[model samples]
Target: MKKIFTLIATALMTVGANAQDAKFQIYTEVEPNTYAVTTNLDAVKAEFGEEKVTEAWGMGVWLPVDYVLIDNANLKATTAVDLTPIYFSGNKFTDMQKEFPAYTGYMNLGSSLGQNNWKGTEVIEDLTALKAAYHGAVSVFPKVDGTLSFGVYAGDNSRSIGIFNMATEDEMNEEIFMGAWANYYNFRHDGVEAAPDGTIPAKGSAAYVSAEVKAGRQYILVGGANKNLTMHQIKFVPAQGTGINNAGVSSEKTIEAVYTLGGIRTNGIGKGVNIVKYSDGTTVKIVK
Candidate 1:
């Protein structure tokens, strides 16, 4: 009896260890101008408070552009990848030149509106033309149900997280800072909310009511004080109970059936929000 019990215990321990090891295996991808990284879905949700994560699909994780591209070079290929310079106000260009000195890069979509003004009214100076600054600058994330998001900045900066979508326009913000001098964005899923008054609700305000995040427009943020933040890394966390293969492979049948939350069947997977039904009658949610 004792020997049998020992064998069973050892089996259980090995299984537990294997599960833990699976989370550390981060997956990465690189397209023409975009790169991505993903880790264990469940692990990310656990960190973001599974309850606060909306009920859609995908996740967004932001790190400084420098960290992701130049400094730390978290992604192996980014160090060698050429970042086409997009001149912003001539200052960003001069600064880059001064910093790199001997650098001669390609001309891509450079913004004259300094990196610090990505969230400022200047971004919409020409209301008709919304020129998105894409100097490897990641802006405007999609808000879906069950998605997790976090922000990263340089020099340990802290500022308000202004939530903007088309429906509400740019009139609302979440003062996501605890106190002055705080560095990281305090992800507040409860209590703190956005209102039409163009201000964030105070902490512990029970009367605060905010709209649910919807599709058709972007859900982006504007920092309280521009910390000179540039988009870094973005994470796509799989929704809970979705049998998403962390290894990034699924059955052929699973890829065939794609549906939106509105029950409309799409010919194939489209960008943005998508809920997928699997062959085993199990449904999973995803975003592109």
Candidate 2:
């Protein structure tokens, strides 16, 4: 009996230890013009081979531009192989243009906007146009040596354009600053909250309320409507380390305000007040 009890306790302790050691992993898909680095130098060097790894700005990592080019080349080759069927089909230049916008756009430019016709007329024209556009828009910033480079280009008017360095795994784990950019949004650090459907609510409205987060949770201040059919200010002090408390005094205060202003109809002492119902199955309510 004593041995069995000891064995069970040991197994429980090991399970607890394993649970504590497990960390959350967040993965994001790589986007165009973006580069990522591993935190472990030895691991990175091993995967990339020592020759491909280099030191940039005192930090050792793989070459950013070269890495992007290599991946891009592989993608292009795969696409070309898959497109072999189109060559055999009775597809004309116009049909190809209709099928591939990017290819068509390039062809339009290569023909000098319909100026000169060349052999393999359509393909050459499209490629030439694409090359001109690529050269006009894309600029490469090479590091001191010829080993690494970063690409830059002008984005849409609403979006900001620039090169951004990424943080290595070690830097993220240690919270060390790795790189800087003019336009960066830290959604984790920012006080913005999303609705149940993951849509950001409008600012200054109950749908999208800003709150002070503490202990990995958010607290929002909900206000009640006033007598003049407008929303009145109500203090909502949320409980620490949890979301808004629907049954707290702060929620009651909002209910009272809304009832006084005729925004909500209530019955009985313990009944809740209905604020609004959304199509996404979320209900905003206040309770006593």
Candidate 3:
């Protein structure tokens, strides 16, 4: 029995040795870009430069003089090659007096579609240096295989939001009905609000919407219609809770028993390495 157990453990170890531990990383820190509400002109000028500030004044108060670059310190952690300064394309204008999408705000912070209607506000993290068109929606390079979550706020008029990916920028165009979409409740205002009990409420404010994502791939998020929706935050995290195991085995199995390294049976997974036996006659080691 001892030799059999040793053989089982060794075989399992050999199979699990190549299993990559699950982890998650975001290209940029998830926070509200507050340039929309900034009131100090000098501070804005200091960060955005005097020339851009002057241009905004001449064009409009809410217009973007140029694309806003969002810096990412953890780019190399997820991406083998550093792709920093993700570009938030500014609102375009045909003439100095008229903005393409009326009431469109600057690109760095939050923006509104206004009458521009669903022209697809872009958030490009260009990995191929293609300098793709600015209307391809929310383009990002995910660092690991996980699910992308968007914390967003939308008024009553908000429409469906779609999530998908493309191999290269060449696949982007004005009309491409790619990926799946879901319409969620109108969670308006800044973010999820706290209830009277001080616990965070999940509805009627910014809420998390998830989509499937692959590691080292480019994904896009775009609104389905030209309506009132504002993205407050976005992030990615490892997917879990699926009915699968590290060895790619699929069985309707449940934990039958658990034992400590010292051969003592435990009620549940304790605070260290444990040997877990499943109903399917498979045993594996877990560390807490």
Q: Pick the candidate with the highest TM-score.
A: 3
Better candidate by lDDT, 1 or 2: 1
Candidate 1, lDDT over the whole model? 0.29
Give the per-residue lDDT digits (tens) of candidate 1, residues 1-288: 011000100000011321221111111222111222322335434443454233212232222232222100111111111222211122223433343222222112222333331332332212112223333322333333223232322222222333333222232233231111111133222334545552333332211112223322333333333223322223333344432324223444444466653556778667654445455443333436
Q: In candidate 3, which residue ranges exceed 4 Å CA deviation?
A: 1-44, 54-136, 169-204, 239-288
Q: lDDT per prediction?
A: 0.29, 0.20, 0.35
Give me the overall lDDT of model 2.
0.20
How would the candidate models be sorted by lDDT, starting from the highest? 3, 1, 2
Q: How high is each candidate's TM-score?
A: 0.28, 0.16, 0.37
Clash pairs of candidate 2? 106-126, 107-125, 107-126, 110-129, 224-232
Question: C-alpha displacement of 121 in model 3, angstroms?
Answer: 20
The TM-score of predicted model 2 comes to: 0.16
Candidate 2 residue spans exceeding 4 A from truth:
1-68, 71-158, 182-288
Q: Which of candidates 1 and 2 is the stronger one according to TM-score?
A: 1
Q: Report lDDT (Cα) of residue 106, candidate 3.
A: 25
Better of 2 and 3 by TM-score: 3
Clashes of 1: 10
